[model samples]
Target: MLIGEVARRSGVSARMLRHYESLGLVVPSGRTVGGYREYAETDIQRIFHVESLRTLGLSLRQIGQVLDDPGFAPSALIGDLIRETERRLAREQELLKRLRAVDASGPTAWEGVLRITELLRGLGSPSAARRQQAVLAAEADVPAPVLAEAALAEADPHVAGALRWALARAGEDVVAALAPGLESPDADVRRRAVQVLADLPGDEAAEALTSALADLDPQVRAHAAIALGARGSAEAVPVLVAMIIDGVNDVDAAEVLGALASDPGRADAIKRALTAELADPAAPGPARLRLVQALAELPGPIALPMLRALVSDEDRTVARTAAALAGVIETQDGV
Candidate 1:
């Protein structure tokens, strides 16, 4: 059985399972490729037996010797139990006296209680401390996969968020890699699901992008738009342009789509995106400015009319960006 299954079945935490193995009380049946311990049916039985002996106060060494010799005496275990009871009784008495003194004296005599309380609350118990180490080893970013292997960890928010961002930037073909995870039933698994589908290029990624665009989460849609742009899909161009046009209030989507026109082959598409915005009389000033800049990057006589008109644009930033592009195009021509 896997360690998780073993832990579930045995009512012992996985930590104790390895601890038992280390003490030579139980042996692992095998190991996973990641070196995770695997155990057999017999390992559980051995653990149950060892736990019984421990409750009866067998020292670990005593247990080991007993395992090798069926004739081992039970008197040694009885003596160990007696000693443990005496030590516990002494400590209990000491703590009880201190508790009584503190209770009778009141807060003035107990200034250290507040500090002790904070320390106790803030401190990590030894068992709880191992959780951080386990998370570090399991999280993808510590050894984050390149290309398309980024994935979420349920327990670590830092790892989950980082892995999602990495997958978001993992290039156009990354969508194909996330195909299986998109259908995953787990919510944590669902978080990084959309990035994979949206990164696929062309019309192939459009339906996925459309679905992401319609998702309830804005981040999901924003990432979808980014993936669509990365895929550089012409089909996505119109949808992306429309979204940018309607999304003037959307800073992130605007930023992602604006970056697209800066790409070489998409210059005309950016020009078209801008022209579409310019034609919309209700367009926001900021959105129009973004459109004007996108056009400028793809500067040509095709946008000369729009440029000349934008030179007199009501928004100063729009005119400024339009003028800059016309100057650059003119300068390039002169070159």
Candidate 2:
């Protein structure tokens, strides 16, 4: 076959076939009397092979090595292709996300588009300061979902706080955007999600935080519990009590529980949960001590009796702390 016939059958353009020949990827096996390039059956097969490799994102140079070098191992090149493909996919996904965010902002003009794009770039910047500035500068123009997504992924405390504030100001619609982060495989991401959800005011945020109560991460559960407790959700009582038992942010957990106890019914429930932990045989001495301190955070009337009862307990440290707390409660009561 001549070059024209080869191009027609193999779907490689004549110009490209000539370029391939120049690179020695697939030289014609013979020549006609007029000195035009002529291809043998084997040459056509090599052209098809080069086209197949191009579909796998192989560069011309890599294809040359693959086809020409008998010693070349394809596994290494395949691995590199995989990595490059992954990176390209990640870039495309990020671009799509940015474009969606911009479109969701409902930009009315090219100026609005440019402004949102700049803000998004700032939010995604490597510098925490720039991200913080972006969040602080964000207003009603920035969509709640955008802020929520940024808040969930933020690592720096200051930047994260700003993003949460922005999300909160953006309104309760952010709950939908933030909900997925609660199920994230990364504990840190789940924690951040709950943290922002805790500050957001709405049933959606509350419901999201309520679900997070059972999160495997202790910190995530603690945050959710505290938030729920503050929102007057009795659901937080058990986890707050557990936080006391585990000595993880037990002080803050106890404070939330004490606030929850302001209601008579809730006060009784909180009292039972605390006393139950204190009475458990598996409860360690240190945990008991923490529980004793947590009990004091309750209303004086509710806590004083428990404190008085604990004063005579077997653990001397628990007794001393309880006795001291009981005395203070008694003096406050003028008993």
TM-scores for the candidates: 0.40, 0.94
**Candidate 2 local accuracy as lDDT?**
0.90
Model 1 accuracy (lDDT, Cα): 0.59
Lowest lDDT sum, 10 consecutive residues, model 2, at 164-173
Q: lDDT tens digits, residues 1-335, model 1? A: 88889888878888987887888778888888999888877877877887787777677787777776889887877787799899999989756744543343243534544433222232222433443333333322222222233342233445444445555554444556555555555544544666545433456556656666655554565566666665554445655565555553245444555566566677676666667678677888866766675554343555556677788777788888888787787777763
lDDT of 1 at 252: 48
Worst 10 residues of 1 by lDDT: 138-147
lDDT digits (tens) for residues 1-335 of candidate 2: 99888888888899999999898888999999999999998898889889999999998888999988989999999999999999999999999999999899998899989888988999889999999998898766688888888888889999998987788778646888887898899999999999998888888888899999999999999999998998899999999999989989999999999999989989988998988889998889999999999877888989999999988898999999999999988898898
As a whole number from 0 to 100, the lDDT of residue 18 in candidate 2 is: 90
Model 1 spans with C-alpha error above 4 angstroms: 1-158, 161-191, 196-207, 246-270, 299-305, 314-317, 332-335
lDDT of each: 0.59, 0.90
C-alpha RMSD values across all candidates: 21.5, 1.7
